[model samples]
Target: MKDWWIYKGDPAVPTDRRLARLAEHRPPWRVFEGKVDPDHKVPSLDDKQYAADRERGAGYLADDAEIDLVNTALLLRRPLLVTGVPGVGKSTLAYSIAEDLGLGPVLRWPITSRATLRDGLYRYDALRRLEDANLTRMQATSDEQLLDAPEAEEGDARPADAVTPPADGIGRYLRLGPLGTAFLPTDRPRVLLVDEIDKCDIDLPGDLLTVLDEGRFDIPELTRLADHRRTVTVGTEDPDVRARITAGRVQCRAFPVVVLTSNGEREFPPAFLRRCIRLTIERPGEDKLRRIIEQRIGAGAAAAAAAPDGLISRFLERRERGELGTDQLLNAVQLRLAGAWTAPDEIGQLAQATLQPLSGPDAT
Candidate 1:
């Protein structure tokens, strides 16, 4: 099934027409809004953003195994379950794929102890509904009085301005959660990041199996579309000047790129694992670490260049010695730069202070 949304340009076309074109051509499972960040040359990972992302970080070293896993997920149309130590860029893989594929903004669902199927699918905005209910009630009361009064004009029989009774706001207030947003109607492929999935309750992963297998969910609160229908509107935050509206269950015409991350804290049920393509993210090599630091800390032309060689060496040595991980390396670089540490002594002190001794299970 193809995505039906289309874009027609105004007489005066803008320079960012590429963004609109990308949106127009997106597959059913993809969501595309025109350039999210226009100032940044990358255009926020929409179809038009691919070229810029490639130019920016093309040389960064990534493991062939990890790259192959990504390729397999894309080909097989299954969720890629990435298990790894924290700070090893397991979460970053989703963004990297979004950037590489020009898939628009990554929809992230940060799993917590309380995360559930409902939380991943939709979040009810009760405050907005309450305000809307008050407005509708006042409007209805005013209209009743207007109807009771005599009509000012002859044959002006318009049923007291038939107030379109506010839609049943109960279920209408359900807005798409990160997972729901990924399934919403769109023009381009979307990347769904189910981050820290191990942190969620056990049942949550099993609950996702159905959606992962069938790519459709039923919201009984809203009207159902034809069975096996490929698209539905979940809901959207009001765009400027528009009132909040609920879109039905959006079906995907094309499978989405689903990247789920786990920190190896808990084991998923075998059934849950069966529905996904699992991959383990290994620690970064020295070369990859250097590139990561340079990308994040602004190398050469962007800032006063730091001793990238020395910093990376110390970071790797400490990591090998089990004192720090990749996350600390990036943190140390930022802290050192912020503190205006350009000398060897300052770098040593900064690394030691930032990377505390690992304890208990983490040390192993």
Candidate 2:
């Protein structure tokens, strides 16, 4: 149906406003039913970074094809792989969808050269647990040491060190990461942004396949305790929030909206690529660049008119010679408006510094 469109690319829309299709629709491929921890709450949307990200995402000007791809990914329950140069708003798309759909906070997993799949799932501080156990053992005191043995005859009271409780239950040392948090079970899907995924190691992309397909993952640390400690409350990605894991497994009732961004630095495995819905963002044209400026700041602002006239034209002209990101344009505008230099030539030179090419021999 025409009304099936949830994200219409209109920045004016707010959250808590889902279309009938998204509200009633259920993924036919969904097989797991994760039980959410009633006390666990997602981070509040009032954070400063959250506000800035929401604004940037809402202002993103998505074309018709981009919009179609987003909706398609949502219906098919697949990850959206966005490839583009830096500053093209690939990562912001996830925040846009989250804000538009009333998803509380966008779960972000920033990739690095050393990043691994396990790093994004959860962390078990086994060493810290071991240290605490050692400290408890060393601090052992007897009743006679406390002078209680002389005052009152002890019948069954044992030393504090005699009964050490499984290092205070393994849950205290466990915490979920961004990827793990995003897969948490709930009626509505959470938006997950895997930023700069291409920066990860060669194996990371292929490593993500299992969870992407199953919408579930197992925590061996928690699984080991299942025999006795059935439900373990552990820390979540959200600060101060803890969740209960039943039988060491984390499943999802609704698959998260996973958006993986890439700089196209390297090629991905064909098998990994097959599972994702792909979208490519090209450099914004002069007109769209101006729109981005207006969207970020009002067109009437003095900063909008900071650069004399040919600044944008010059930017696009040099873009032909080397790769330049839109952020460089914004930076140049800010530099000009900052009153950093007075002489016209000096001002031009300073602005040029901000608009340097991101790639090519000129980059250095």
Candidate 3:
């Protein structure tokens, strides 16, 4: 028996059989129904954005261990919990995975304190629907009054009939949020970035566990109308892209590549942690930072003269004192190499201001 990874994490690996391999590893307990319309369209990434997304790994290097963790998550069909300090490219990992495997545009659900599971799934605008209904009713009354008028001016032309849009089309009022759209039964898995999971309420992580484990969710509003309307097409987070929900259910053909990011602000419950494949991204070392700079700035400029080796040393020194994001070092290097501060006297002052620690003044 041969067991191979769905994503080998190599650029050279052909993705033609990726979907098949993903389906093969799915646990027997998991069920799948790929009833999605073959014609259904997801949003397309433009050339400029696509090119940028493909270069996500160039911004930060993901080591063999990180790559193995990602592959493990994919093979097991589990959500990846990525924890890191700010700017370690936890969020960027989602984009890299999506682009590397030709997964469609990432569906990002940014979490906040007020965010609930329902919020991530879909939003129903009941107030807007009610307002539209009232407006339509008034328009109809006005049209009726005009038609019922007995007298008309001799040379005046009759006004054109008013057309009222139906306010009860249910689907128009319902739009699937990022999470819901990810489970829309596309031929391939979607990449879902549940950005900043640590910021969510205490209950949210537990709430998410069910959906991630099952790979399906229901919309009650649509369910109520199921008898009359078996299928409803609704908007997704992607502009102009709508998914078809059959009998008010959204289920996955393949489990999505769900990357939930956290800044390691808080701990999650054991049960919530149990189902996820977790990866904690450590701060990049000095060697890694040099390579990242060489990749972003020209390799020639970063390695040769005027590249600011002093700035790199200053960045590492600050790391000993407090948390410092990699981008701060990149910025300072770019400034020095561009001749922003050619004078030697002001170098320390400028580097200090530019590479400020991420934590508060009280942290020390």
Candidate 4:
């Protein structure tokens, strides 16, 4: 993506050399103080804890090919662009990677129509500025009175102990947006989920090229003040600006795991595409579907026993006839189990009613 060697330098190196470089950046896997074995850096489903995470969320069947792609993205420190239909778990890759590396869950930025660069970096606060100005005025007023009244004795403490110059206004308070937070100086890399990028305007994706390539962004508003002043009034998560300045600009300590998802609705600019490794998610196979259903429904044996003879046959018949998808099959099975529908007639009726109409031409 964007010539990985451009900002970060040449990527032409042996596997071991690349891994060594990644280590120097303090990648997420290195910062984890958890049960993840360092010798086996890539945590797989074979690991119990990793399996638990999979169970908690829909797991990515990270086949060997997928692993290679993941490793390449990490080594290059470029964005991984996942494209697939809805419900195929493209966005979940970020979460899984974060969990595998013990970097915690991802910080998600759900793209929308109004999203902009500033929206993803920081938000200005007017209330804090007003309070700061008010405080400054009050202090100035008191100093004026003390100066006008009389002169103090020599060596006496100055009347105005130097007004601490009101705290920087809310405009200086910059809390990291999801993207900003992901770049924050962490002991380990953070995962950033740019979900449904297709929903955003065309220009938004292009705008991200700079920061993504540079591995940093300057919060001019915050940086300008932070560089020159010790304390500035900035917005806080608090309701009142007068309350406190709790947020500040944070710089990146390491590259982050950036995953951007798309629903294949719109194409991105060539420049944007050039900076990402694209992965297309395929629909789950029959066996995978069965496993998913068994995991979700708790009727594994029952569903399997009945599948070959009639249940699966009927399910496929409907699916072949464009009557249902995998989700509906699972839904019907769960309903059958919950209702104790053991007889073929009962099960068929329930499955047909639940799935058949939904896929029909007139359904929508």
| Alpha-carbon local distance difference test for all models | 0.62, 0.78, 0.80, 0.61
Clash count for each candidate, listed in order shown? 9, 0, 0, 8
Cα-based TM-score, every candidate: 0.68, 0.86, 0.90, 0.66
lDDT of 4: 0.61
Output the better candidate (1/4) by lDDT: 1
Question: What is the per-residue lDDT of model 2 for residues 306-355, given as tens digits with 9 covering 90 to 100?
Answer: 35544576677678777888777777666656766445556457546766
Model 3 C-alpha lDDT per residue in residues 1-364, reported as the tens digit of each score: 1235455444455775666667676777766776768878866554465667667734556677788888889888888999999978898889878776778788889999999999989999999888888887887887667666787445544356554676438888999999998988877888999999999999999998878888899999999999999988888888887777889998888788999999988999999898989998989876777777887786764564234546667777778888888888788877877878758776677677788888865222
Q: Model 3: how large is the Cα RMSD against the reference?
A: 3.2
On lDDT, the leading prediction is: 3
lDDT of candidate 1 over 144-236, digit per residue (tens): 676667764555565654545445335456666777666644445568889989989878988998877776665654544334432233353
Candidate 1 local lDDT, residue 52? 51
Stretches of candidate 3 above 4 Å error? Answer: 1-8, 49-51, 152-163, 304-309, 343-346, 362-364
1 or 2, greater by lDDT:
2
- Candidate 2 lDDT for residue 212: 96
